[model samples]
Every structure is written in structure tokens, then in C-alpha cells.
Target: MDGRRNGRKASRRVGPPTNRRRRTGAAAPKDALVEAVRQSRAATTGSRVVELMARRALVVAARQLLRQHTDRCTKCGSTFVTHEPAFVHCHYCGRMHRVANASLLEQELFEIRMGLRLAS
Candidate 1:
């Protein structure tokens, strides 16, 4: 009866109990789980921010490429043009210009007529 059971002495470790409640002091299990969830959510939010920045960068790069490869209007000598399937429309001159790279079928079907009269 010298504090020994089955000839094996008890553990000599001197510290608080292994239970989380006793170590944390009055914090419930639900509170600890909630805290862990909050930390994980913060990490997820950080990754989402990085992904959004990457998407914005890609959008900016696409816009730059479009600006570089824009077509100029031959009718009005204007660079501000809207690209269509078979032709490009010039906003400055109000004229629909034919595209040189269009297919022959599209070229014949969508003919570029004279400029439209703009309201003064």
C-alpha cells in the first residue's frame, strides 16, 4: 500500500491535469472550438484577397493588349472604333468601315455603307 498498484508506481509528472478545461480555466469547449474556427477563417480570407488581386491584374493586362491591337478607322482617320463581327464603326465620323480580315461571305453580307448623319 505504498502508493503502488500492481507493482507500478503512479506517473511522477507535476503539472496541471491533461483536460483542456482545467488548463484554460473556465473556457468552455464550444468557446475553444469557435476560436479555432475564427483563426482558420482569417487564413481563408487572406487567400481570397490574393486571388482577387491576381484576377484584377489579369483584367488590366487584357485591357492593355486590346488597346495595343486596336484598329483605326480608314474613313475618318480616327482611332476610336468599335469592333463588330465583320466591320468596325468609327464613333468620331459615325461611319461603319469594312474589315480587311473579314471572310468573303461576311464582307458581301455586311456591306459598309456611307457615314450616318449626326445630330448637330
Candidate 2:
């Protein structure tokens, strides 16, 4: 019968009302998923860079050896011409080789040539 009693009954009947317009202020799950993808891509790219560097180093070493002996295989001592780059093959060993760092190979070739001249 009292006003306070009626207000309490009305509040209890309706229960608590939820706010429909309040921002959740939390990052979406998709955003976290995207961040994870980005991190994975970065890791993959870093590993690829390392792999490329190793390949380059191997190529440089091979080139240096090739330059040291123009007509001979570095691995098996088979003879060939410098002009035929692709056709060059170690007949005895049958290994394929390629030159990558031409400048370094040339320098090494010069050093070896000079050393042989001095030795003679």
C-alpha cells in the first residue's frame, strides 16, 4: 500500500536493465588472430633471410675455388674451358658448379697466378 513498497516491487519485477550502448572496449578476437599471423610471417621472413645468406656464402666459396683454377674442377680436378659456363662439368666427379662472386674470384685468381709466378 505504501509508495516505497510499490517502487521496490516494480524494480524487482523488471530486474536489472542492461546498458545497450556502452562500448565493450576490448580488442576483437580477429585482431589477436591477425597479430599472431603477423608474428609468424616475420619469423618466416627472418628464417628465409638466413637461408639466403647461407646460400650466398656457399656460392661465393664455390666461385673463389673456381677462380683459383680456371680450367680445372675445384672438387675433382677435371679440366674444362672458362667460356662454357653451363657446359662445364667435372667428367670424373660429375658435379655441377656455378660462380656467383666474380670480383672476389678474379682477385683470388690473380693472387694464385702471382704466387705461381713467384714460385717459378
Candidate 3:
């Protein structure tokens, strides 16, 4: 009787719960856009907005760092070298690589446009 009771308990614990209906409520879908918007707007109209902006800026900087470090040479196993703000040159095969860091490049381009506008 004791062995049978122990075996029953062990089996019950080992497998999924027999009562599947006990889990309530459907899980929410993972939405990156919704989360980003929520985080962006969570703070009221002042320092909170600035802090959120700073956080976003840091995230962008980290992403740029990853891009710079992880870019690999196609011909050899070396990381590509940054030749210009928007270009990298592979040292092994002397291949020029161009990558668009959309936001950063856009900002630089905008600055140049503004300067040209002022000059004109």
C-alpha cells in the first residue's frame, strides 16, 4: 500500500498537472513596438522624457559599437576596419564595405544639409 501510494505521488509530480484547466488567462503576445512606445511615453512632459531619450541614445550607441566590432572580413577572419563614418574597409582582401547606420547617417546628412543651406 505504501509503495503504491509513493509511486502514484511520484508519477503525479513527474508529469504535467492532470488539471490543465487550472491555468487561467491567455498569455500576452510579445510586441516590441508596443513596448518601445510604452517606454517612450511612460514619463510625463519633462525630465522623464529626457531620461528616456538618453536611454534610447545609449541603446543606439551600443548597437553602433556592436556593428563596428562584429563586422568580419569575407576573405579573412579579421574584423573590418572603419575607413570613414559610413564605410568600412576589409584589411585582408582590400574590399570596401558600406553599411548604412540609418539614424546616425541621417543625422549627419541632415547636419550637412543645414550647413549647406546656411552657406547658400
The candidate that wins on TM-score is 2
- CA RMSD of each candidate after superposition: 22.6, 24.4, 13.3
Give me the overall lDDT of model 3.
Answer: 0.55
Q: Against the hidden reference, what TM-scores do the models get?
A: 0.26, 0.29, 0.24
Between candidates 1 and 2, which one is better according to lDDT?
Answer: 1
| Superposition error at 67 for model 3 (Å) | 6.7
Worst lDDT run of 10 residues, candidate 3, spans 43-52
What TM-score does model 2 achieve against the real structure? Answer: 0.29
For residues 1-120, what per-residue lDDT tens digits would candidate 2 score against the true structure? 554664674344366787767677976799898888778966658654433558878876766444433577767776743423223446677765554434644544655665833433
Q: Candidate 1, 91: how far from true, in Å?
A: 0.6
User: Per-residue alpha-carbon lDDT of model 3 for 44-118, expressed as tens digits?
Assistant: 333443334588787776644434424675447577454445545677778655454535556457557658334
Error of 3 at 56 (Å): 35
Clashes of 1: 0
Residue pairs clashing in model 2 are none
Worst 10 residues of 2 by lDDT: 80-89
